[model samples]
Target: MAHTSPAAAPGAFVAASDVAALAAGAAVFGTGGGGAVHTSQVVAEQALQEHGPVPLVTVDDLGPDDLVMLMSGIGAPTVGIEMLSSRHQIDLLVREAQIAAGRPITTLMAAEIGGSNGVGPVGWAARLGLKLLDADGMGRAFPSAAMVSMNVAELPCDFAILSDVVGNVSVIKTIDLHWLERHARALTVASGSICLGAHYPMTAETARGAVVEGTVSAAIRVGHALLSAADPVQAVAAELNGAILLTGKITDLDRRTEDGFARGSVTIAGTGADRGRLQRLELQNENLVVLEDGEVLVSVPDNVTIIDAETGQAISTEMLRYGQRVAVLAWACDPIWRTPRGLELAGPAAFGYDLDYVPFKEINR
Candidate 1:
């Protein structure tokens, strides 16, 4: 059932009616990675209908003894859209993660509140009768698992659980986030480039300061604005406190799956009043940087997302096609991402670019 522009559900709950908006908002936060949320939205809605709305709560709402587990899909967005995970596989993965953590996961949390990762766990929580945490490790999506807040906080993940659609599960024990990323990525690649993963099981008290808070509700609101407004681009920009960097048509695209990620670049030719300008967007699962005439317009850990110019709907990195008109929307990431440790993990340099991290304010100013 497709829902559009439904009145917001009161309280902290994700009903079936809210999935479309959540998906829309989550895709905006995805910055072009995190896989597309269209399919995940459908799945989530169905689960909610069958099991009732998942209770959405924040760290403050959870007890100190409540165990929260980070849940997400690990893979190239290009492949994730093609290879989907089954509910049974996700159930198995979550159970294994809980067992490895030596506690039942009382709450489910999105590792990243962007794209399909943001919406996938909604179904998981509803199906499993667990609460959904309103916060996420990354306020937005990043390519590597090492870029998460838990990693930046130096939190130890005793074990990482992964499972593909075919029921194959792997349990990896390592406190090293980088090692986890390496081995987990290799496993994802081997699993046809898409798999479900769970890690960073922590109590509510430990997660309160470590995760980006209020993002789940924020995404739902932004999605509503996108659905109801006459001008989606303007509505989204205002909702996210973002700016439209460029409005143009995608003229060229070079993309491929390598090293377990969708790595590519796209060239957009400016249209409308801003004619004759050309913008280049770099990609690695997510849109990492935007450049015009060799000058950086935006870069990680900032948000750089592409949306349908006319409709204001986010276009995932895996969905890019030549001649599709788009607008580049960008916003500053969470303040924590600007810290020294955060930059070291997710800054442009972390992605192999030789440049210092610049705040979105400075660039826009």
Candidate 2:
């Protein structure tokens, strides 16, 4: 299904009324990647509450001369709960990126429209007095920075400005987006495993051609639909053109924090419609693969999200426990992700699955 209806629009931008719902919905879309939303939600809510509504600018609103960039939090979700970013720190990072460009940075955009990183830009835009774009880089979360649609369009990161809460900062100028991610990952690990940064500076004209449009509104719409419905998870999945893949209790969780990532697998003892079966999931900061009876079911580029069966809340990888009742859902990724270049950056092979990715539509066929 289409992510949103244009007639039920929130104008040219995501209004303040959409922030909370956006966070809730983004968690489901996150598919267990990006940082957890609880802390980021509290922070974003507070910013919106104080700032009224951040201005949301669409690609059409931009002048060809306008400058835009991506702002997102990068780190392991497990560590971020204990270490939250000060709003001023996020503000500082954006300012530096703006200054580095030696021109006004017209709008700030999300690198991915999922989890905490999705809504984090809304507040940052208002605090910095810049317009927040309704467009985004990735339609959902991915583990690597180079996995964004902007890269698929061949737009370089240009310059990056990253900062930690503890007062450390780095400015990066890279020749390739791949090296940009590698250096940023190393910096993220060095910055206490979590930090906020901005990159992929582009002209408004480039943003129109490269970025995924209306994704912020799409996130809010999905969130609102989930909240108003009785079966939020199911509604969210169906609304997003996804499916409920399994109903089960997490029976075995083997996870470990490695190289600034929460990497591992979760085993679920199927229940309800799937009683007596077992499902397994591979993780790398986010849910990357799915299997049932040891047969590969879903992989990266096809989002696999684990939600609380009872509450319809998306469960972050760090929050998985050995006995939590959950529902695992799978949705087709954005079309950009299905292209050869897109797959090379985020397909099952990219995550070391040793298998080719089969598109959701193909599977349904």
Candidate 3:
């Protein structure tokens, strides 16, 4: 079904259908990470029914000085399947963030536009009566919080809050953004590998300067394209102008749960037009790289997604297994990530790859 925008403004009167569409769209944008769409949609529906719809607010609509809070879930996607979060988890993070910021949060925004992260902010916004921004930091899903373009641009990550499902909450103040990511990852690990967090409270003015614009709309478009097209993979590629990096059957997979992160790699034996070729995918919570014949086809900062060859359903990194047929897609990242400074912050090298950063277009072309 083609997605239709809700009649009422974003937060005004969200119908159950809107949440359904948004969730569906988020799944398409998830790009092989951000947890399951079904789970996030169920949680979002319950939150809306219980607390009313989240209010929608544009970045421009917010006052130049109004405080904005960012929130999302962080941890292994596999862990999220079993460790469901409670309403208290969300509330605790918000409460701690409010205290740490020393001001009431006027609006809330998503850290990324994907299944879990996208809907997460809405749940908090509805419960807190804070306006939800119609934009996000990353237009698509990514594994680490530090990979966001906002962090690449040197946006502040000083005061944030983290809370676990078991009622453990901490307000964190970090001297640097990298330290913020390090400390948060440790807390999430100790909290059983998944936790809810709220951070990066930038005023509307600062947000306009730092955040990626129109990502929520882009996610909605990607979702609609996937659902409406005769070929969902082709639809996604056309919408994002992405490349089909590989199409193959999973021949081997190596994975492990270490340091609270689901890290792994899969080797694919190519078929169809890519017959006899070999592709390798490296993942850490999210698919990070696609290599063809030992050459990098696509790498971090850009999106590397794997989907079912027949169904076009996104296959999570943790769920990848041998004998599965898949298609690998590569979408270009935000332009900011291509800059020298941005590369130093989130490129392949930062992820511990020795290769210099290369754009998907350059690699594919």
Off by over 4 Å in 2: 1-10
Candidate 1: tens digits of C-alpha lDDT, residues 1-365: 00111222345789999999999999999999999999999899999999999988877778867999999999998988777787699789988887898878999999999999999999999999999988888999998888898777777887889999999999998659989999999999888989899998889667757888778888999999999999999999999889999999999999999988999999999999768999999999999989999999899999999999999999999999999999999998988888888999999999999977789879999
Estimate the TM-score for candidate 1.
Answer: 0.96
List TM-scores for all candidates, in order. 0.96, 0.95, 0.91
Query: Per-residue error at 106 for model 2, in Å?
Result: 2.1
The residue-level lDDT of candidate 3 at 145 comes to 70
lDDT of 2 by residue, 237-329 (tens): 888888888899998999887777889999998898889989899999889988877677888888889999987889988888888999998
The C-alpha stretches of model 1 lying farther than 4 A from their native spots are: 1-11
Q: TM-score for candidate 2, please give it.
A: 0.95
Model 3 accuracy (lDDT, Cα): 0.76
**TM-score of predicted model 3?**
0.91
The 10-residue segment with the lowest total lDDT in model 1: 1-10
Q: Can you give the lDDT of residue 110 in candidate 2? A: 89
- Number of the top-ranking candidate, with TM-score as the measure: 1
